[model samples]
Target: MRNRKNIAVKILAVLAFLVFLIINSRSISNPFRTGISGAASLPLKGLNGAMRAVKKIIPFASLREENRLLRERIDLLNRRIEESGTLSAENRRLKDILGFKNAIPFSSIPAEVIGRDPSNWSNSLIINKGSAHGINDNRAVISMKGLVGRTLEVGRTSSKILLITDPNSKAGVIIQRNRQGGILVGRPDGSCKMIYIALDSDVAPGDRVITAGFGSVFPKGILIGEVAAVGKEPGRLYKYAIVRPAQDMTKLEEVLCIR
Candidate 1:
């Protein structure tokens, strides 16, 4: 194949040189010889044009292949960029969790929110740490902001949590300014209410609520929420206050597991 291509190139070069000489001839006096050369050059010129067309085609296919490879490389780089963004976000979240863990004085296990209960989405969640990592049922769960929930079920490396906003969940809390204590219970709508507050109590909205340290389940002074509203009925014996949780339960990502 190499020898054939070399021969074809040499033949074209010779024909092109013959054409040049025939067209620019000044000393040729024979009309027969000049006309014969012109006729021979006609076929050679067409052949040269065909060779140029083929040469153009060869480079075009190569260029297309190079363009295809470049496009693939760009796509790979784009995918890597997306993955880098995701990892950066994860690193930031992990740093926040670490800072929160360091700030707390008590012993706790840091766990990542892995999943949630689909059947009762508002009530429960799953964490990455479980019985194997010293996490078990009824252990208190909290976030950097405040109390999240308590451990419900435990596995070897995973566990489910009962959110504080769940209607069935309950905690004992107290007003920070005053010693007024009450039962913080969850509502169906995912908010908590402090019950058994006295009507004449000096309680107001925005009062900070924290764990009373009286219960065996949750320890001393973990923040629960802030008072959103105080409710009073004319005939009611006790005034109840609506408590807004410190933690955003809907966005649970990392939490502290206190035994």
Candidate 2:
């Protein structure tokens, strides 16, 4: 029994000595440490690749958001440019109206055209001024270009004007070049006719017409229109002319009332 115990002790001592040698000696443990390190590094390398891919994706999303903001800014600038152009044109037209108002010789009231008669659009207009603004009935209305019409009805805040193109409108006009007298009346086609012109009169197309100041209805020397053509009625003893109005009535925006 003593000898068996001795052999067991010897075996235990040998095993402990081998473990101590492996921990203390670098050359002996190097292959095992290298194998362990290589095994662990496989998972670490995969994790590193995943982190790099996430970083790339983040910058791309940021770029997309930046591009979207840039597009919005460009659209906003375009609308502002268009609005500026419209405002400039309106300013120029108002300046022209002011200059014309200064040139007229009568006591005048400036009024804006607010509406048109839907039932008689080409023949009448509604102005913003009324009796409250000293607008009176039968007052002459003119524009920067030429005569427009006369005030027909007056109200508290607004008034209606009968344009010279209306069938019921009439004025005494004369040929400006020769002083030939005639009566001007409106036609349904939005033009005027100068009747009572003598057949022997040298009235021709391109001749200008102006108010004759007869009956004190309209002031003298106000432009009416130019003669487009001249002809005689078959059974009548006089000649007539088709007169185009000096101003474009369809585009009227402002007017002056001869107060």
Candidate 3:
């Protein structure tokens, strides 16, 4: 049985060779026939298909890498855009502050807010400008929004501002809406309390408050803040009111020094 099986395999191989030889002979005699070329090119076509599969996988990996790189570039661009926006806003605010200083009759200096009091509730800031820059004690410090504080202590190159919200700081203010007068005093919690406001005064919430320039500390017409709330104690002689400071002290970055 084994001998017969071996003979059968040899016969099959010999038959296939004869078939190939016949096909080649016909194509050689008839040039229009494609049998020889088709048979000869089969191995190359199979190899090309395998290569195509490999090439397809390569592109997929390349596309994934490319997408990752593109995402990284987008992230970098977004960060740059955010920084540019912040810079533009800062430039505008600084320009406004400069314009305000230019319009005033007093000599002015520019300063950058460098630090704040460790006590968060304390209304004070340290500036980069001081005696060296002509900033002196009691010089008014202001921002685009309004009065920030007065220079409390002066160093060679830096100064500390006693913010209007400091408990010891006070400003004589008038109600812009009705010309009522009051003493604006800072509370420990960063808001101003209006003292000596008449009980029957026509003051209301949202009234604009401005420095009266009576004490000669702050300039007239400098915006201080808007009325936040109003209330009266049962036996008090005056109505107590809270004023929201125009300058957002927590966000202060730059200021003008008025001499």
Candidate 4:
């Protein structure tokens, strides 16, 4: 610091001496004074140009920093908006589930779906509740829309649900309009087939199907699906109706396990 101050003082002294020489040269026609004055003017011009460049660079650096800060603030606001949207959607879903829970008379345990069966032959889901939460085998699983399936292979803290779309699943269901009963079985195409219907029954494409309460597992009045088409099973004496499940099995997220 001391050395820098000394250099600065020396520069000031040189500038003052240059100024004096230039003044004296203008007053008289001395050749040596004029030469010194011309030499000092060159360095002064270069020094002034450097100072102007430094002044420009300082503001430029400050502007760059401000741009960086503004970008960071925009990114932060975007993340917060995304998080708020997610929270609002979750809140709406939970409210619907709560409404469904209150409307039903049966006791239920709410569970979140966590995993799925990876094989192509079987369709199933794993829930986050099991025997520890009073979930057991053959317990009816449902969502707000309709029946999901029945629990199977219940573990202490998790359970696998046999979705109605699995080929091995079976349920007793009846048509809501005509009261016609049939055996609902899963098809390979991710839909249910209500078989063993009387060929003369008034079954149609738009009939609503629901649980018949024929077993101790699934209760009565739980919606199963709607009939999409009706056809006769080849080489059998019964008519089969293609039924689409009330709940979309592909997007199951949360469910209720009936006690």
Best by lDDT: 4
Off by over 4 Å in 1: 1-86, 120-122, 233-235
Instruction: Tell me how candidate 2 scores on lDDT.
Output: 0.81
Q: Write the per-residue lDDT of candidate 3 for residues 54-146, one digit (tens) a residue.
A: 854664555555567578677566556655775697688877877887887778898877666768667888777667678877877888788
List model 2 lDDT by residue over 1-259, tens digit each: 9999999999999999998997887776545633443344345445545765675556555555555757766655544554566567778888887888888899889988766656653588877777778988888899987889898757656677888888889999999999999999987788999999998999999999999998666899999889999999999999999999999888887899998
State which candidate, 3 or 4, has the greater lDDT: 4
Report, for every candidate in turn, its global Cα lDDT versus the true structure.
0.79, 0.81, 0.78, 0.83
Per-residue error for 72 in candidate 3, Å, reads 6.2
Candidate 4 at residue 201, lDDT?
Answer: 93
Cα lDDT of model 1 by residue, 62-165, tens digit: 55555675776775665566557756977888888888888887779998776665665358876767677998678789898999989875666667788888
- Give lDDT tens digits, candidate 4, residues 189-220: 78999999997998999899999999999999
Roughly what TM-score does model 1 have, to 2 decimal places? 0.65
Q: Which residue pairs in model 3 clash with each other?
A: none
Clashing pairs for predicted structure model 2, backbone only: none
Candidate 2 deviant stretches above 4 angstroms: 1-74, 120-122
Lowest-sum lDDT 10-residue window in model 2: 33-42
